[model samples]
Target: MRLGALGTSSIAWRRTLPTAVRVPEVDLVALAGRSADKAERFAAHFGCAAESGFDALLERPDVEAVYISLPTALHHEWAAKAIRAGKHVLVEKPVGVDAREARELCALAEEHDVVLRENFMFLHHPQHSFVRDLLEKGRLGTLSSFHAAFCIPPLPADDIRYASDMGGGALLDVGVYPLRAAGLLLGPGVRVAGATLRTRATDGLDLSGQALLVSPSGVLAHIAFGFEHAYASTYTLWGDRARVTVDRAFTPPPAYEPVVLLEEQGHQERFTLPAADQLGACLASFAAAVRAGGTDSAREGADLRHDTVAAMELVEAVRREAVRVTVDQ
Candidate 1:
């Protein structure tokens, strides 16, 4: 699958592009950025061509698919355009600012007979499959509760994530990780029970937040995220008979070994999982889906579209139901 990139963002330069170039199934064809110098630099670094602009990249006949690392606000617009151009699209997470935008983009992809996917790269990590195996074997017994948190130190004032109009907020950025993880572990039909947000008085962008959700079977999930805290990315699942905790749950570096802790009555166990390149795995999956291009591909696309829309719906619900608190800073 010939792939073009639509942004010179950090994730594109740091993770996605490097991984794409390594995937045998993917051919890195071109890169586009608003700044020609940056685009040329990125393309040169990755050994691909540099396009004049995003539209130019999309217009390339050699580009069969596009990776959109643009800001959250630009996701729907560029993804819609790419789908209409008959290009499979892999967009950064949060797919859109809200559910409506997500639904519209999905509809466009389906109408144009193209594949549209959101880049939740963590889901591609093998550690998650390992956890599922433990769950299936009753390692955690009957699940009773889950807790997740993803927090980070504040960014520079000029970072795009501090701009409200650009879809910047803890919820859209880090909060979505725990939220999506909940759905991944708890299954579908999880509903927001209550929520809270701490917003900056100057810009109304959320700095931190917490949410409570319950699955259909009554298992509870507690999720917390923030842009003003010591870094943490972890989750714990509690069951009637035992409990399991995962450190570095969300953004593990490709070479970092992950450890899962399991505890029961008078016994504790630790399992260390192999290091894996999740971003490479994610890009490879996208390439395979684009290459498949038939009923099977269509089914995968439909399933991914559904997951994207469902995640957005959960985000929207949190925003709507959250008890708002403004901070003077």
Candidate 2:
């Protein structure tokens, strides 16, 4: 698959471009940036063509797919444009600022007969499969509750996440990591039980928040996320007879060994999961989906769309229930 990237964003440089190049199924072919100089620099580094803008990149017949890593607010716009141009898209997480937009994107993808995938790269990791296996085998002894947290220290004032118009918020940023993890462990049909959001005083952008979600079967997930705290990305599952804990649940390096801590009856069992390149897996999966096109229908795409809707619904509900916190108050 010949892949192009829209926007020379930081993630494209650090993770997306480098990882996509490593995927055997993907060919990093082009990049588009608002600035010609930045686009050329990124394209040179990745050994691809540099287009002056997204529209120019889209015009290239060789670009079969695109990775949209622009600001959150621009995802829907550019992703829709790419789909309309008959190019498959791998958008950054929170594919849209809300459920309505996500639904629209899914519809556009369907209408255009192209594949659309949100880049929740962590889901592609093998460690998650290992955890799922334990649950399927009843090793966790009937799941009860799950707790996840993905908090990070503050960024500079100029960071895009602090900009309210750009879909910046704690819930949209680090929060989505644990929220998606919650769905993974509990199920997709989770409902928000309650939530609290803290917004920036100056512009009303969320900086921290937490929520409780309950599944139809009564399973619960407690998710906490923030942008002004110590760094941590982890989750723990509690069951009737056992508990499992994993560290670095969101951003583990390709070679980083994953360890799952299992506790039962005062005995601690630790399992070492094999290291894998989750970003590569993500890119490869999307490329394969594009190659298959509409001929081979995929349940994963449908499930992803469903999950995206559920997540955005929960986010809005939490926002409505939130009690704003500001620097003055």
Candidate 3:
């Protein structure tokens, strides 16, 4: 299966995809970017085929899928096109800028009878399951609360992360991971009780954050994210019996070694998450589903659509309590 990668200012895929995609079964055939000169350099640098235009690459008879790692704003446009072209699509998180777009994209993918996977790579990792098993086994005991935080300082004054037009915000960029962890670990269908957003140097974008989501079971997950704050990154599930803590839950080093502190019986059991590139695993699964005709005969597509819409619902819910900390906005 030949795959085309679209719009990466940084070569994240160059390092990660090789591990996730089976080289024998999948080939990185083409790449597309906004810069022709940069595209040439990226192709030469990554050994990608000369077909650099995104549209042209999608038209390739052998190109079976398109992995879209572009900015949040560009995802819907390209992903929709890929689906219409009768090819499977893997879209990065925050699948759409809003609920309406997400809903439409999901419907379009179904109409075309193509695979549409939101690339929430963490969902595919075995480490998550390993921890989840402990949770189910009552190791963590009765679940209580979840607290997750992800923060990274702005790269530059003009970095895309600070740009509002690109659907940029601490909540959308970093918070989503923790928020997803909260929703997933605590079980889905979250209702936001409150949210507090801190504005950055740039107006309208959250530089720091606080969002509270409550599950039907009354479990609460608190997410703290920032584009200008500490390097703290961790996901913790607290329970009546004990708590399980995982450090570097998201964007972990390529090695995929996650550590956890399991407290029970008056002891702290330190465990290491296995070595793996979950992003690759996610891609592989989507590919497998495509190869098998599908995992749910378009029912999987419906689930993807549901997830996209659900994510947007949370984002909009959080935005209500966003506080302006700067004069710019």
Task: Please identify model 1 stretches exceeding 4 Å from their true place.
Answer: 294-298
lDDT over C-alpha atoms for residue 152 of model 2 = 94
Compute each candidate's TM-score over C-alphas: 0.97, 0.97, 0.91
Q: What ranking emerges by TM-score with the best candidate at the front? A: 1, 2, 3
Any residue pairs clashing in model 2, and if so which?
Answer: none
Residue pairs in steric clash, candidate 3? 20-280
Off by over 4 Å in 2: 294-296
Leading candidate by TM-score: 1
Instruction: State the weakest 10-residue window (summed lDDT) of model 3.
Output: 11-20
User: By the TM-score metric, which is better: model 1 or model 3?
Assistant: 1
Question: What's the count of clashing pairs in each model shown?
Answer: 0, 0, 1
**How does each model score on lDDT?**
0.90, 0.87, 0.76
The TM-score of candidate 3 is 0.91
Q: Across residues 87-112, which tens digit of lDDT does each residue of candidate 3 receive?
A: 88877787878777888887887787
Off by over 4 Å in 3: 11-23, 294-301, 327-329
lDDT digits (tens) for residues 175-212 of candidate 1: 98999999898998899999999999987899999999
Best by lDDT: 1
